[model samples]
Target: MLPDADAVSRAAADLIGSAVRAGATTLGVATGSSPLGTYAELGRRVAAGGLSLAGCDAYLLDEYVGLGADHPQAYRCVIRRELVRRTDLGDGHVHGPHGDADDLDAEARRFEEEVRRARIGVQVLGIGSNGHLGFNEPGSPLDSLTRVVELTERTRADNARFFDRPEDVPRRVLTQGLGTILRAERLVLLALGERKADALAAALTGPVNPDCPASVLQCHPDVHVLADPGAARGLLDSPRRR
Candidate 1:
């Protein structure tokens, strides 16, 4: 496990930079407190001429429904402010599902098609205290695809810090499915703090089941998990946690 959040971020950035340098054409970026440092490190790398993401297509893991284009908490806007604006990523090539679409189902289909058309070579993720990945809450099926999902109260509460109040958080989201996330050539997950300990442990060491949506990563061929001391505490008992 990393010594602190900053170390985790640097390690994640190193992997992502390596992927880009090795000819990866598509990258998936995740938004949340856990990944913010990693994005910052990527920005520093680009500024130093050590990395470049301008040639890659970037996809967001999820977006809140009904958030306006200017909504500061909107995942798209957050991504723009945190990663795209901070690095060499092209603004026009960053794509996310149209969460506020008039026809949610159709939009889901379209977004999934877009992601599949240009596969994501690398994906970054963060686990929710409730075991969610990309808004796929605890009960999400292993084979689920990109779709709209009602936000779990627990998940909403955890994300409330991003908004002015708990009620201000959106009630629904469009997120890539477990299957869709697995399609990426490689995956990197960063989980920090004691709050994420249970889910983090379960995702890496527990059974591959729907109860913990992120547990589906166990089926993936390539996945790298980074956790701080607090988050890795539960893994101490599981040899399989590796």
Candidate 2:
């Protein structure tokens, strides 16, 4: 069943709380509007009750290739502005691919190794309008791991909001592939808005296809989808929700 975004955030916070209590050391996180509420609520928890993140390790899902680390819309900057700076997670705990690195391949491999060593306890994801998960666009191999990807025309258009002009958007990205994301013991996906309703229905009720990469989550044992009422408009009529 589709859940409201706030309910999803609360559930994610509860899971994070449980993980902290259980001594989980690593977390996989994603960017975009869908996770904004989750991060906000988590920040509140840190403020109100002292949810310690000092010992936790964090791995971000993706990053644009040419954007500077300080770019306001860069994933690194977004993480810092949203969750990292708001909480007590130390400087070294938050990890993401080096967007400005000279060696992109080496950076990708390093990220993959970090994930291998950390063994993420939970992964938070936000589905793309085109059904991508972490820049793993249509036809990405189900078992693929970390890699550099050329953003599709649709993806570039969707992300143009972060750039001054459509031409300013980067054409390529580095992201954890489907296999890398699925390696997390638990996965939480957040979707919202009417524009996302069709994609949500396709992902939850339609056949699993490379064309709709998010649909693959249906096969995972521990995947939870969180969508607001607008995003769940079609889902409300689905048999599973009823």
Task: Note the Cα lDDT for every prediction shown.
Answer: 0.91, 0.84
Q: Tell me the tens digit of each residue's lDDT in model 2 across 5-32.
A: 6887887777777777788878888998
Clashes in candidate 2: how many? 0
lDDT string for model 1 (53-112, tens) is: 889889999999998656898888998999989998988988998777899999899999
- Which candidate ranks first by TM-score, i.e. highest? 1
What TM-score against the true fold does each predicted structure earn?
0.97, 0.92
TM-score (C-alpha, index-matched) for candidate 2: 0.92
Model 2, residue 147: displacement in angstroms?
0.5
TM-score, model 1 to reference: 0.97
Question: Which pairs of residues collide in candidate 1?
Answer: none
Tell me the spans in candidate 1 whose CA falls farther than 4 Å from its real position.
Answer: 239-242
